[model samples]
Target: MATTPLRVYGGVTGSDRQAERRALFIESGLELLGSPDGEAALTVRGVCRQAGLANRYFYESFTDRDELATAVYDHVVNEIATTALDAVAVVQEPERKVRTGLARIVRLIADDPRRGRLLFSPFLSGTPLVHRRTESTRLFTQLLGTQARQVYGMQGSTRLELLSGFLVGGLAQTLTTWLDGELDATEPEVVEWCAEIFLATSEFPQQPGRTSIHVPDGSEP
Candidate 1:
């Protein structure tokens, strides 16, 4: 069978106009993913319609459907991480930072149901990079490990790894539930709930027994 030449929507024409069109094409693909009528089983044709481009245009920018999906996933991840990290930047205290980060993340997901669905859903199973469990695990582990060392004064790297692994599991499960529509709270309410969990739980561990300690200023031990 003869293959048709795929034209990518907003394909680069080496001109500003082409760049603008390509941006529009990418944005349109995300919009389609978020549309009320859109399902998780998205396609090149569907994205083309959403972007108002010819089906052939999809190939001009992407090699295949999997490539397109990877682009969409990268877009969503960058957007979410940038937004959430911005919210966390001003937080000075480690505990507050963790709380604010989680709240911001949950709020982001709640605010954009489509993005939440994309991040939490299984649609990326079609893509190789996005579907790798080991990669996902490593990323989450690093995030949580940093939080532990910075916030809790976790001494050893091994300890940080163990704690981070447990914390990431909780976070991933929580996000997956939020994405699956298992929670019915407002965004702020969700944020508050997430904050409470983060603050009181071992996920963002506080100093052990320090909560009950009373050290006198004039005494030297």
Candidate 2:
């Protein structure tokens, strides 16, 4: 027997064709969400307008705006995670891995300040699915700690946790500032400076419980 087609708001279509339309809907939602005044409010009708689909098509993929918001957030987070992880994947040295990963993150933010703003928005910070950003940051922190353990024999989950949150939070705030128009530094310059600060803080030889690190001036990539 052939499988029945999935329905969006009770409208049915072939599975493959439905998936394509859903993708288009999601992409369009993201574009709208990343707009200059996007975070003010998002509605099903607004998203439908952006996606150029009938009101019914909005429900084909997402149950509501919150659902669509979650999907868009996930898409943005995945993009950042992939870029950072891929940077670390090709490096053999711990310092290089941290450097490249941090640089890649800065570059990603620089590539699209508006997208960065939405990705780092405080609105996405506390919700359940929205917490994926924090989870990803925690994972990166753990990865860095694991790397440090293998190389420097620095071992302690708490220490690593602190380091990870500190570094990721710092980077997040810095990128937020840039995206919010509070910074004047170029992307390359920002990334380079951040790498130095991050590596220095990450590898502080003796301080095992430090929570924050300082960024130095004149540090350019």
Q: In candidate 1, how many Å is residue 94 off?
A: 2.2
Tens digit of per-residue lDDT, candidate 1, span 1-221: 99764455465444555555567666776676556544454577777787788877677678765666667667777776677678767888877787788777777777777776665555444455356444656776786666666666666556567667766677767777866768676667766776666566455443344456677888766
- What are the runs in model 2 whose C-alpha is more than 4 Å off? 1-3, 6-13, 122-140, 143-156, 205-221
Total backbone collisions, model 2: 1
Best candidate according to lDDT: 2
Cα RMSD to native, each candidate?
9.2, 7.2
Write one digit per residue (lDDT tens) for candidate 2, span 1-221.
99765655545456766677788877776777677666444678887787778898777778877787777767777787788888888898877886788788777777766568566766544364456666667766676666667656776666676876787778778888877778999877787888888778655655545568767677766
Error of 1 at 195 (Å): 2.8
Give all candidates' CA lDDT scores. 0.66, 0.72
Clashes of 1: 7
What TM-score would every model get versus the actual structure?
Answer: 0.70, 0.77
